[model samples]
Target: MTIRPIVRYPDPRLVLPAQPVTVFDYALRALAADLLETIHAAPGIGITAPHIGVSLRVVVLDLDPVEGARTYVNPEIIWASPEMILHREGSVSMPGVNDEVSRHARVRISYQDVDGNLQTEESEGLRAVCHQHEIDQLNGVFWIKRLSRLKRERLIKRFEKMSRN
Candidate 1:
């Protein structure tokens, strides 16, 4: 039950791509648990290993009341629908900063569970948006990068002000 510190935006570590998790042993399990603890503490719906400066391609999403925490290790998007949609996306790393991001309406993803079992899921709407967002984080693509110049500038300005206060 360790709530690791969340790495904030503009941190170089957050920009560096996370390495894929190769081992499915105790350390990886511990990391998943830590991610869950940290995200729940952040009161956020999603979080990744990179958000905690661990630099691993691991993500934890709370599906609570259904299956609790769902951990994805080394996730990859296999396919995306031709259709698109917009959803508000934010990061646990970049707190208080969010914007509506356009993404494929549906996506097929392949990933490993916390115990290292391979799994695949096809999702749409908000769920698809979240999976894509977290996948971008794993690939070192900050959510701001998806925004237009004007929106990104404004978002940064707002984030700075929040940091000050």
Candidate 2:
């Protein structure tokens, strides 16, 4: 397993939609492993393939507060509840800043596992929020996008001011 470098925000590549995995072969599996390594190395809860310069519909997340990580290939949110839950969200791409974002309180996701087995799981609370955030990355969307335009602008300005000091 290799720790892949993460692509930060405003990198341009993050906006491009990811490609679908065609050959679910050894290389693909290796990529997944590398993604897990990279996420763990960053000590992050989730990562998307595009962050590592791989434009594929892949995401890895460790919502487990205790042990174990979960990898998702072609993950899709099949169902989401209308109830909104606001959580303080941050991103590996957008480092050092966290903002409150509202997301579905519960969601059901379906994806293929590492062994090529199809799996579906229902999640709530932090796990649900993480899944939504990671899945958004898979679609080239960031948490900031969920914020209002004025809020996003202010956040960007704040980051820029901090960077100069």
Candidate 3:
């Protein structure tokens, strides 16, 4: 599988919601494989199909190499813990910027495995944060939006300056 191009921040495509994966086939498997490669190349812990301009509800993650790559197709958060925690958040799309963002410390997610079988799992700490972050990407919300207005503006300005060099 080829390493697909990742859609960058501020691109309209990144803001558009992804469509659900209705077919589980070779193409879907190939896309997940490509996503795994692309995310590893991007050096990110997780990635969504939308990250590569593929408008499908899919995400790939490998927070721990020992656990290897984990794929989530048609993923959704079914429940979130009331007790919140602050975890630093960033995006492969935005790069070079991150900030502490509050999120549910634990989450229960319902998603399809790479084979398209329904699977559910609960996670906490960094793993939970990654899930929420990537799931937001699937919903067309950029991680930076979790920042305060001042922070968001500052980060965007910083990103702009970096882009100019």
**Evaluated with TM-score, which candidate comes out highest?**
3
Query: What would the per-residue lDDT of candidate 1 be over residues 1-165, giving only the tens digit for each residue?
Result: 699999888899887899989899999999999998998889898898999989899989885558677889999999999999988888887788889999999999999997889999998887788899999999999989999999999999999999999
49-164 per-residue lDDT for model 2 (tens digits): 99898999888887675768777888899999999999998877777777899999999999887667889999999989998998888888877899999989998888777667
Q: Superpose all Cα atoms of candidate 3 onto the true structure and report the RMSD in Å to 1 decimal.
A: 0.8
Model 1 ranges with Cα > 4 A deviation? none
Candidate 2 regions off by >4 Å?
Answer: 65-67
TM-score between model 2 and native = 0.92
Clashing pairs in 3: none
Which residue segments of model 3 deviate by more than 4 Å? none
Candidate order by lDDT, decreasing, is 3, 1, 2
lDDT of 3: 0.91
lDDT over C-alpha atoms for residue 142 of model 3: 88
**TM-score of model 1 (CA atoms):** 0.96
Best by lDDT: 3
Taken over the whole model, the C-alpha lDDT of each candidate is 0.90, 0.86, 0.91
**Residue 159 deviation, candidate 1, in Å?**
0.6
Per-model TM-score on C-alpha atoms: 0.96, 0.92, 0.97
